[model samples]
Target: MFVGHAVFAFALVAGAAAVRGVDSSRALSLGAVAAAFAAAPDVDMAYALVGVVSAQTTDALSVASQFWQTGNLVHRAMTHSVVLAPVVAVAAALWLRGRRLRRRRELVAAGALLASVVAIAAVVSGGLGLLIMALFVAVAVGIAEGTERLTDLGSRETFSTALVGLVSHPFGDLFTGLPPAMLYPFDATLLADRLSFSVDPTLNLLGAFGLELLTIWLALLVSLSLFGYSLRDAVDGRAALGAGYAVSVLLIPAPTLELSYPFVFSVLAVGMVGAAPRVGIRSRRVELPDRIAALCTGLAAVSIAGFAYTVAYLVA
Candidate 1:
């Protein structure tokens, strides 16, 4: 779902920008900025992590519980609200407007980073935890800046593109889990129930997972289209088919971590299918067929890992 948010945002913005006669390079940069904004709401997960650390929850189950509990309040809260889109866009526009002010921007960013660290320290443990988190944020910010610089995207353009993603993000959440508080602060009400294909296991085994897969595939296809690449050029049909087979494991009914025999067998079947030869090696040049073979091999390895994990879980 996290990846879906980013990919969908990128594709949506890129496609729109292209339609508006934007250059490919600029469109890519705008898409990246939009994707970043779309995924930004998940920054609330940091709050959950801080809670876990503060509670000293060492066990897996305890940690998971704390994570989900915090997530329920913060995940689709104010950050994911429709109102946040314009607010963020305005801020981004102001920050990135006019000539680049590298020194001033760096100073402001550093100050904000320090303040965030101080706030987290007040809530969570100070010493090592605060330092670690501060370092993490610094690194993340640096990476983001580097990405923007690489794309050579102006602030105004980026902010304009980001508006679309920010606004769409909350609505997109409706397909997966609980709908976000689109009208937050003023209204804490959920916009709608999740749009599920079928909750019944017998009727629809894919559930939310299927929707996520579809979202990811659709996003990928849109992105490829924007980049002037055909589906065949961008993706290997054989590898895609292999992935489809592997995903069937998720459909088999199993209680949480418990794996049924059918699920286990499906995993093995997927592995076997992925491992099967679909292309022949001829020349030294790396062709699409070779890439397809490599993709299949990777899928096979993943399926094997899943099979091993299921067996281990069953034994435990």
Candidate 2:
């Protein structure tokens, strides 16, 4: 869901900015900033690499389990907090505001708040955890700095975008595993259960996968619009070829959330058909707009095929 997080954030931030009268191109740039901030909260997953390395297991499932067990120690703690999201947003606003006004006090207060988040992370996780979270804060503030330097957007606008990206990130986890410690450091657990849309584990995994595909498709639609091309124009009828992916339902073992790599890899590989060169076509002008449209169309077709397989699997 890491890439899903970025795509979803881009659609949201860009759409919101466009609604507020920002130019489509500039709004898309703002969306890029939001996407980076949205993925920043996952820095804690870096620790999971440590576990995967330490475990002397060659099996993929064992390695994945090790990674999750270690990652869970800090994955959704301080960094995923709705509480910290606001702190980071306030810090960003103050820093940008202070820089614009040359107010030393506002700058100092912003620095203090940002530092306090790292301190809380150390208390919640541990020593190295502090460094990982500091990276998270650095990314949030750094993106703000980059936005101020690179874009015409003002401090307040940046804060709003950052706030949306950060706050929306943890909610994506609700479908996959343990729900985020939403009210972190407060001893409250408001949303503890995964929104498993079905009772059967395989069906639940498909539902989660379907939700991600839907999210990406929605983002792709908005993105194509921002690029000034309608999706209908961009998509080629050849994308129907993706329906062949359904054959995988018989070839590979049924997948659950924990061991979905085979299904995911096979299904996503269907999108590669979009990249195949057109033979004997005289129009040789290769461009991103056309290519992206083809890619999205192929992905859309494969998602439909995957959903059909899920239904057939459930019926059987």
Candidate 3:
């Protein structure tokens, strides 16, 4: 659920913005803010890099194990909590406050507020917690400041979208590992266990992987809607080409997230079908929508290839 968090956030915010009659560019800008908020929670992963550095190898399985062994120290803690969403949103908004009217009182008030937030982090998770929060807020506010400069969207929209994205993100984590610490900074269990899709380990992992793919499709669909296009327009006969990828089901070993390159590389190659649809003349420029169509078509092909491979592997 790495990118799934941001994908879901983008879909939720951007789709709603389009439905509410906001123009495309602004909606995309707002979507970027939401996506940033959704992604910021994972900044705790910086703690995991220590393991990778120590392991000193690029092997996927080794790196993943090293990552989690260390990341579990604080990965799904305070920032992932719904309780921290508003406080974080407010901190991010402070950066957007127009400062031409800067005064000692206002500056002092801001400083006090930030200091209080820092104190809370120290109490909740200690020194590493402050570092994680610092990195998280920096990334989030950087994106927010960029969004403000690039679009006319105000703090109000940012607040609402931030809440939606940050709050919704933890649910996406439920299938990957233990449910996120949804009530973090406090000791409480929300669900207590990761959701299981099947009794078989491989089947369960496949189900989760497919679920991740669905979120991507959802985000792409929302983008297409804003661009005045449909899924039908993007995916076409060329997608059938992906079926050929199923042959790899026999050629390579089965893949899990720990070692997925064989399956991932093979499936992604199916996306080349998108390049098949080209302008009649090489000299003419390709329109954005056409490029978008190609991308969607590629995704559809990837989906087909993934499904075909999964089924082939299972049945074999």
Which has the greatest lDDT?
2
Error of 2 at 38 (Å): 1.6
- Counting clashing residue pairs in each candidate, in order, gives 0, 0, 0
Q: Poorest 10 consecutive residues of model 2 by lDDT?
A: 280-289
> What's the lDDT for residue 64 in model 2?
80
- Per-residue CA lDDT of candidate 1, range 1-316, in tens? 6776877888778777788988877777778777877777666566677667766658765766677666565567555657545655544544453225554764465455445543543354345444433443443344345445566766667567667767877877776556887775444576567665555432222333344445555565555556676655433344434434434435655523112335434544554443454445665453334443443444444444454444443444
How does candidate 3 fare on TM-score?
0.86
Rank order (by TM-score, best first): 2, 3, 1
**Residue pairs that clash (backbone atoms under 3 angstroms), model 1:** none
* Candidate 2 off by > 4 Å: 59-61, 99-104, 281-289
The TM-scores, one per candidate, come to: 0.63, 0.90, 0.86
Question: Candidate 1 at residue 239, lDDT?
Answer: 43
lDDT of 2 at 265: 80
Residue 298, model 2: lDDT of: 75
The lDDT of model 2 is 0.81
Q: Please, what's the RMSD in Å of model 2?
A: 2.6
